[model samples]
Target: MFQETPQDALVGTWTNSLGTVWAIKADGTFQVSLSKNHRVDVWGKYTVTGDEMTIQESHGSHTPKSCRGKAIYKFMRDGEMLTFTKVSDKCKLREKNILAGWKPWKG
Candidate 1:
């Protein structure tokens, strides 16, 4: 039996109640998009250590100037559901969006 790694558990597409989709890849990269229009809101790289995730946005739709900084979050996964708690983040918008929680995206 193959045991899933921490990265493996996080690698997939998840959607929030706000109709936003977050896709986390195996390459340490991630993208956030809107489900309605499929417009990418942000794209970035992330590193995970245990339950902690650090995200550094490479590009985004809003406040591009302020989005370059790294944001740290603590996340928990329960089956198909995933939730995040802020550890340290200077960007309020990013923090708000991430705290919304997510579930596996069937799409």
Candidate 2:
């Protein structure tokens, strides 16, 4: 068996529970928008290992001014499509949304 790389987790663009699209950049920066021309954050940090990935939300017009959110996801790749399930953790609201399959990822 071969060892897996952390970079693998950051390879695909993903959508949020609310149907927001977020692109995962090759340089570990992420861009997400809540609507057309209404980008929440132009850039943010990303950390990933194996099937798990976390995107750190940045300050922007689309995001809450006082909100500091991190989206943790488990990725599953099927051909050109990537399905990211939110990792619920201990947050009931977070868990519920993630498990509901509100997010999707693709090339």
Best by lDDT: 1
Cα error, residue 76 of model 1, in Å, equals 0.6
Query: In model 1, where do residues sit more than 4 Å from their true spots?
Result: none
Candidate 1 lowest-lDDT run of ten: 58-67
lDDT of 2 by residue, 1-107 (tens): 98657666445566655656667677887676655554555457877777887766555644444334676778676655556687734334434434444334542
lDDT of each: 0.83, 0.59
TM-score per prediction, in order, is: 0.88, 0.58
The clash tally of candidate 2 reads 1
lDDT of 1 at 37: 76
